[model samples]
Structure formats: structure tokens, C-alpha cells
Target: MSEATADVRDAQLAERKRVAAATVDTHRDALIALSHRIHENPELGFEEHQASAWAAEYLQNEGFAVELGVGKLPTAFRAELRTGPAGGPTIAILAEYDALAGLGHACGHNVICTSALGAAVAAARALDGLPARIVCIGTPAEETGGGKIILIENGLFDDVDAAMMVHPGTEHLMVRGALACITLTVRFHGKSAHAAGAPERGVNALDALVTMYNSIGLLRQHVKDDVRIHGIFTKAGDAPNVVPHLTEAVYYVRARSHTYVREVLEKVVACADAGARATGCTMEYRTDRMYRERRNNHAMAALYQQNLESFGEHASQPPTHGGVGSSDIGNVSLVCPTIHPYVAMAPLGTAGHSPEFREAARGEAGDRALVLAAKCMAMTVVDLAADPSRLAAAKAEFAAAQQAEAAE
Candidate 1:
């Protein structure tokens, strides 16, 4: 538009950003308390009743209409804030609060969920009287179950124009993506007999499992550089004297693309088949939940980075080839323009999902990162709500990426 109009819009956008940042600062203590509470509790996927309740309650107190148990998920919730009319874009701020099985908050989901909550509230406060909609979605089960995938299936993300969330990591990264992944459970059955006394009468199932493991090791050499096939022996027989009649293993097959990961999974199953045939054992396998590779919206990520760097905290470039994990948020990215940027909470080279990471998530550095992430995200929301063209650009980028994938 005209220069005067452009200047007016820019002034409004800057004011909205300032208000959003101030709102986050106004509730800094409460927001940090919420994060620490969730970190202390450490609920697992789909079982985060307390965490979900706490998040919903916090949003409700801020004048948002809160709904829990959406999509038939007990721990999932949705908190909505409407600024004026209903025709504006519905921006979703996703929250992930599930903890690891034994590690407890090692994945730093407490930071993820709380930052999202803070951003949503602050953005709503800043965008008051503006024609926009802000939604804070509490998506459980990112660590195990595909909670976001299930929400998508239930049409939770059908109307969302865009989504965003921040994750805690060892370094700040604006554009990192995850691998497509699926888990496989394999079982081999045979006859059992005394190993020392009647070894000839027994069909060794353990031997079959060992053979399949070795075959997978060989197959890894032939796969793509980004493909990863890994497994663990779940059932390797009870005792040494007794010939193992049944053996089981769980394998995770991952790749940069969903189709490629499935192809690799089939190869893994073939390896199991060969092992069963060579050892005279019968083999059966099944697949678990699949996670799509993340489609990071570069346009949206760039906006987020601009806001993040405005705080004087720089971000590192993500690896070009590998060094990534899978998440249910990838499924959300497929549904809407999404950004899952990272904020550093620990020293560089620190491994995630470990005791070190878990401690850092609850330490002083983590607290600072949590608040900074909230302000960055809140400012980004201000950017999108203040300028419609920015959101359109992000959606265009996402649409083009989807078209490219479909062509392949």
C-alpha cells in the first residue's frame, strides 16, 4: 500500500510487539512457576492429567475459553481467545508436556508447553480488540504416542491457519526438522528343549534372532545415509540351559521421508524372514505409530528467528544432513504452516533425554530460556496478527513444499 499506510501498519505492529513482550514480563513469575511445576511432576504421554489441568486452569484464569478432553484424549486441551470478529486467521500455539518413561522431563517438554501457554496469553493480551483468534492447544504424548497425529485425525487442526511452538535444546536453532519414523515389533517362535542334554531336539529361536540382528547390521550399509535402523532384544529366553522357544525384538526404522522409512521397514522384515527360514522358526512382525518428517515453514521460522535474535541471543544452523529425531509435531506441520524452533538450555554438545539435560531443564539457564522463548514466540504472533501478508507468505511456502512432496 501507500507509504503513510505502510508506516501506520509498521507503527501498530511495533506497538503490538511491545505490548506482547510487556505482557509476558508482567506474568513472568507465574509463567516460570507453571513451567517448574510441570517439570517437577513429569507426566508421561497421554497420562498428563495434572499437567493438562494446570495448563487449562492457567489459561482459563486469563479469560480464555478452555476445553479439556478434546479429540477423545483425556490429557489434550484447547484454550481459545477471540479478539473481536471471527473471520481472522486462527493461530494455534501448540503445547507438548509429555515426559520420558524413566528419565522424566529429559525431553524438556515442560519448557515447550509453558512457553506456548505464555505466548498465547501474551499475544492475546497484546492483540486485544484486533480481529484475530489465538488458540493454545495442549498436545500430549509427543514422547511415545502420536498425540498431535491423533488430534489431526480428529479434525483438531482442520481450521488452524498456522501453528508454532518452541523446544528446549542444547543450542538455539530456528530451522531443524525431524525424521519420519515407525516402530516394529518382531517375534520368532520355535521348539524348546534342554540345551545341554538334548540340543539336537531344539529349534533355537535365539539363534534366529541373532541372525536377524546381524542381517540388519549388514543391510544398514546399503541404505541411504539418512536412514537409521536400530533394534533391541526384548525377549532372549529366560535361562541358559533351556533352549529358547520364543524371541522378540523392537526396532525403530527412520528416514528423511515417510515412503523411504516404510521401504526400509520392509527390508527389516525381510531380514527377519530370512532368519526364521534359516533357523526353522516362524517369524511375525507388526508396526506401531508412524511420525511424518517435519516440514518446517521457512517463512515462519525466519520471523521467529528475527524476534529471537532481537533479544541478543543468536541461533546456530541446523545440520544439513543428519542429527535429528522424530516428533508428532511433524504431523501438525503437514496440516498447517508450523514452526518448532529450539532455545538453548544447556551447554553445547549436551545430549538430550539424559540426566544432564533433565537437570538443565530445571536450572537457571532453563528458566531464562523459557521466558525468552515466550517473548520471542509472543512477538512472532504479534507479527502474524499485525500483518496478514506475513501469514499468507508462510502459508504459500508451506503449500509449495506440500506440492513438491506430492510431485515426488
Candidate 2:
């Protein structure tokens, strides 16, 4: 381009950096407060009313046009900010704030939500003359209902060019993929009779449950090493003198991919069926909608890695072997250019969903993760907005990956 144009671009970038630096303290305080507030009032799954409202209000006050209750979920929301000329790419920043049932913010969703909000705000303030649309999506029920999958089905991500979100983990790293999973519930029914009157007249449902558990334990040896099957007896016999008439269990089946998960699920279900047959009881099973494994966009991930490196943090290398956990964000990656990098909240090797990790999530390390993740995400957005070729590369990579997955 012309010298004048180059000079103008340089000036714009300088201003963007200035704005980013100036607003860091302000955004940091807001993020810290947001994290604490959500942590204190921990709401489960799709019931994050107060957390959702807080995010919506924060974005609305910062000039985004906010819409609440998107995708038939009370806690879901969408906030948009447009800049420069129209017809530009729309980039989405997703925030998840749902807590675990009894563990509260043990999964560090409070950190995830605040970091995303901070990233959006930083990007908005640094846009300068870039032509782009910023959308902050408040997705609830990620802990249970898979909110993003429902939102995707409802066309919320249809207009977006790319999406991004960060997860807090024990180490800072870009995960290449996650296992696909399915949730299931199993029930057993049998005839009930008074124990004192006649033990032979009653069929024991508890026996069926025990048999099923043993069957699954034996089936594990034949399954793939990467596959995981776990369950809990939700219901068992009520009283000692009464012949139990019903028993129930909730199970989760996971595999390296969605196709493999289906295969593993069928085998597990057959085991349960065998239990029912052997115990002379009726069996019923239901599988919740399957969750697809994550497909990370390498191009996007690399960009974020570069930004993190600039801040003196080393981006983690992808694993050479073994599999990680599953996430609903995996579903979103199937349809859009996405990044689900992990920001360190605890020390390396610290496991998630435990009391130790939960304690670390609210400490100094977690706070650092909040700031670093926000900065990395915001800088990546800047790179995308200023470099057309990078955006094109991201989209091209996403398309190729989708095509490969379809062929498989």
C-alpha cells in the first residue's frame, strides 16, 4: 500500500496498544470482582440468573447491545459491539459461569467467565479503526445441559466467523482434543413382596443392580484403553424387611471420538441388559444427547500462543499421547474456528474437581491466570482484526478439519 496508508496503520496500532495498557487495571478489578461474586453465590448449570445478569449489565454499560434469555435458556445471553465499517468478520467470545451441583465453583467457571468478559472489554477498547464485530455469549448449563450445543442448534453461532474461550486448569496449555461423552440413566423394575410373608414371591431389584455393576466391571477389560465407563447407584433398596421393587443408576461413557463413544455405549448397555435378564427384572435405559469431542483450530491456537509468549508465558505443547477430559466447547469447535486453551490456575499435576484444586482456584495463582488469559485472548483478537490473512487461514483450517471429520 501507499506510505500514507502504512503510516496511518502504524499510528492506529500504537493507539490500540495504548488503550490496552491504560485499561488493564480497570478490567482487572472488574474481573476480580466478577469472579468473587459468582464464586460466593455459586449457581448450578442453567440456573445462573444472578451471574448472567451481572455479565449482561457489565457488557451493556460498556456499549454492547445486550440480549438476555437466548436459546430458550433463562441464563443465556448475547452481547454485541460493532466497530468501523460494516460487513466485517464477527468474532465471538464465549463465557461460561455455571457451577457444579454440590462443589460450587470447584471447576473454576468463575475464572472462565471473568476472563472472557475481560477479553471482550479489552478488545472493544483497543479496536481503534479495525472493522469487526465483537460478541460476548453468556452460555449457561455447561456443567450439565451442554448449553453451547443447544445454542448452536438454535443458530446463535451461525453469523460468527470464529469463537474463543479459555479454561482454567492446573497448567497453561493448548489442548488438542477431548474425549466425546454420553450421559445415561438406567432403571430396573421387579415385583415387591412382604419379606416376612414370602421371600420367594418377590423379585429383588437390588440383585439386578449388583449384577449390572459386576457385569460392567468385567466388561471394562474388553473396552479400549482410552474409553471410560463410570456410574453411581442413584437408588437401591429402601428398607431391610421390604423386598426392593426398583433400583436406578446414572452412568457416563466416554471415548476418544463420538463414533467410538457410540460403540462403547452399546457394549455397556448390553451389560446392563444382561443383568436384567439374569435377575428376571425389566430394564430401561436412556442416553442423553451425545457430546462431540473437541477439534482445536491450530491456526487460532498458535496465534494465542504467540500473544502469550509476548507476555512472558510459555504456551504448552500438545500431548504426545494419552487423552484429556471432555467439554461441550468441543461441540462448538465442530462448526466454528475455536480455541479452548488452558490457563494455569493451580500447580502442574494438580487434578481438577477436587478440594485442593478448588482452593487453588481462589488463590493468587488463579488470579494470575485470569489476567494472563484475558490479555492473551484480547491480543489474539487484535491480531485477527488487523491481519486479514490470519483470519482467512483460520477459516480455511476450520473448513479442512470439518471436511476430514465428515469423511471419517
Candidate 3:
């Protein structure tokens, strides 16, 4: 803690930062090409064959050991870059490339995966003379399926020292806390009959669905602002003249934490039950994978912010009031010290999952942001590789946060 020691450490970091930035510039062409290729293809999660293959091939070309079809997911992959020694600290940078069903790369995952790839490669080439292992994982199906959750359960991250990824968003941020979420499939069953001849002879399931939807609208006023409930009607009736025999809807219930999500979902389901009973129909519901809230590691975020600022791009604070969605990275944060930061790829206030955002994911601004993100993440990895205490501090922060949440 002496002044002389601190000065030496600062000088060492400055040199590493220079090397990191230069290395990212060296690989700019390949990184930009990869990002655009993924954006143009726009494959959905769990079915990203071309995207996954290109990513693995790129890493393989860069001399990293690659493993495809990781964690039993056909499109998932794991690539590694080892330097100086065999058993050094390992830093894993996550990559998400799957696009939305109809919107293509509207969520900017194209920039996400390529930036992670660029970061891993840049960090490996930093010439800091540090012993470390860089891991880039191609995490598929993050849009719907919990790809990272499955990978963690399969022991993919069991040996990782820290995990990080830069998401493409409207603004640069260390991390925006995500809400816990659950997807529900609700079905209403009723008897069918001819509407014109004998409308009263059969129960109308559409009525039940409409009633339940209205009930949810009213229920939203009673819950906390952190709670978000929304859904769409998937089925109502085959024709206007015939009484609908079945109706279906899919709803997503989200809250600040898992407990609150379940608490709100229980009441939401009750509304459906009442609607079905009043309409003489039967209601049934099922849920998909539940996503947990993300926990950001303070020390780790600070390091990333500092590294980003070193590149002259200021990392801004996220909006305080808004409905934040969920991510599979939340599950990884629960098990390890992880960071899901954001690097701005479009103008401020650009809405995610929109056409504007989709274009930005491959435009000039996105390419610039990708290079910046790579430099920042690689510089941060340099800090972790050269200094063991950086990893320990991140882990300690994560452990403390997890413990506090558990105690609550």
C-alpha cells in the first residue's frame, strides 16, 4: 500500500491498457465481418447453426481450442485461449448470437457475440507477459431458453474465475439489474355450438379469456412498480359465427425477484380461474423456465467502467425508472462473479428490439462500439490476469451479495 508500490502498479496497468487497445484494432476487420454476418443471417435461438459455426471457425482460426455443441445444446460452443502457463486464472467472456424470431438481430446480439470474441482475442494478444486463460463461450438460445443456466448446471462455468459480457444497448452502463420472470401458457376449454342457431347452448371460451385479460389489467394497479405483467392472445375463435371451443394465451409475469414474481403470478392465475368458472369453462396453466434476477459484482463493474473510460468512452448510468426485462445471465450471476454490462451501439433512447436497433446492430456506430467494448473488456481482463487480487475482490463482492440475499 506504499506510494511507490501504487505508482508501479499504475504504470503497469497503463502499459497493459495500451497493448490491449492496439490488439483490438489489429482484429477490427475480422470482428466487424463476423458481427455483420450474424446480423444478416438472423437465426433464432436453439437453431443458430450458421452463426454458431462461423463463431467456432473464427476462434479456431485464431488458434483457440474450440468445442461445439457444448452443454448438449446443438449450437452452443466453448473456445479457449491459454497464454504463458497452464493453470493460471481463467476469465470467461460470454457471447450471445441468437436473434429474435421475426425482428432479426433487433436485440443487437450480433454485436454481443462478436464483441466478446474480439475481447478474448485482444486480451490474448495484449503482450502483457501475464499468465492467464481467456475463454469465449457461444451461449445460444438466451432469448427464450436459459442457455447459460443449462451450461452452468452442466459444469461449463465450474472452473471459471470470472464471467463477463458487453450487451449492445442504447447507452453504456456497468449493468442494469434484471427482473425475475416466468412464462405461463393459459388455456380455456369450453363446448362448441352454432352461434346463429343456439348461442346459449355452448360456453364461449373467448369470453373467459377476455375477462381474464381485463382482470390482469386491473390487477396491475395493485402491484408494485417493479412487477410487470403482460401477454398476448394466441387463440380466441376459429370464426365469428361459431362458438369458440378453446382459447389460449401466453403471459409473462416478472418482478424484482423470484419470490415476488411467484406472489404476483399466483393472484394472476386466480383471476383466470374466476373467469373460467363464471363462463362455465375449464382453465389450465403451465409455466416455462423461470429466470432469476441478476446480481452485479460491484468491484468487477468498477473495473470494467474504469477500463472503458480509459478508451475515452464514458460509461453512463442506466435509467433509474423503467420496466427491466430478464436474462439467462441472471442465473450465472447467482452461481459466479459475473458482469453483464452494456456498450451503446445506437443513439441514446433507441428502443431495444425495434427496427432502429436492428439496423444499429450492424451499422457504423455498432462497429465502433464493438471495437470499444472489446478494448475495454480486454483491458479489464488484463487487470485480472496480471493481478490476482482483482479476481479475489470480485469473488468476495459476489459472495457477500449472495449471502445478503440468502439472509433476506
Best by TM-score: 1
Best by lDDT: 1
Q: Which regions of candidate 2 fall more than 4 Å away from where they truly are?
A: 1-18
Clashing pairs in 3: none
- Give one digit per residue, the lDDT tens place, for model 1 in 1-408: 999999999899889888988998988889889889999998889999999999999999999999999999999999999977767889999999999988999988888888888899999988888889999999989989999999999999998999999999988999886999999999999899999999999999999999999999999889998898888999999899999999999999999999999899988999999889999999999998799999999999999989888888898989886679999888899989999999999899899999999999888877888889999999998888878999999999999999999999
What is candidate 3's TM-score against the reference?
A: 0.94
CA-only RMSD, every prediction: 1.3, 2.3, 1.9
lDDT of 3 by residue, 157-247 (tens): 9989899999988788997889999999999999899999999998999999999999998998899989989899999999999999899
Task: List the candidate 3 regions with Cα displacement exceeding 4 Å.
Answer: 1-6, 127-131
Worst 10 residues of 1 by lDDT: 83-92
Candidate 2, residues 167-248, lDDT tens digits: the string is: 8987678756688999989999987888788889998888888998999999889988888899999999898888889999
Tell me the TM-score of model 2. Answer: 0.93
**Cα-based lDDT for every prediction:** 0.92, 0.86, 0.89
TM-scores for all candidates: the values are 0.97, 0.93, 0.94
Superior candidate under lDDT, 1 versus 3 = 1
Ranking by lDDT: 1, 3, 2
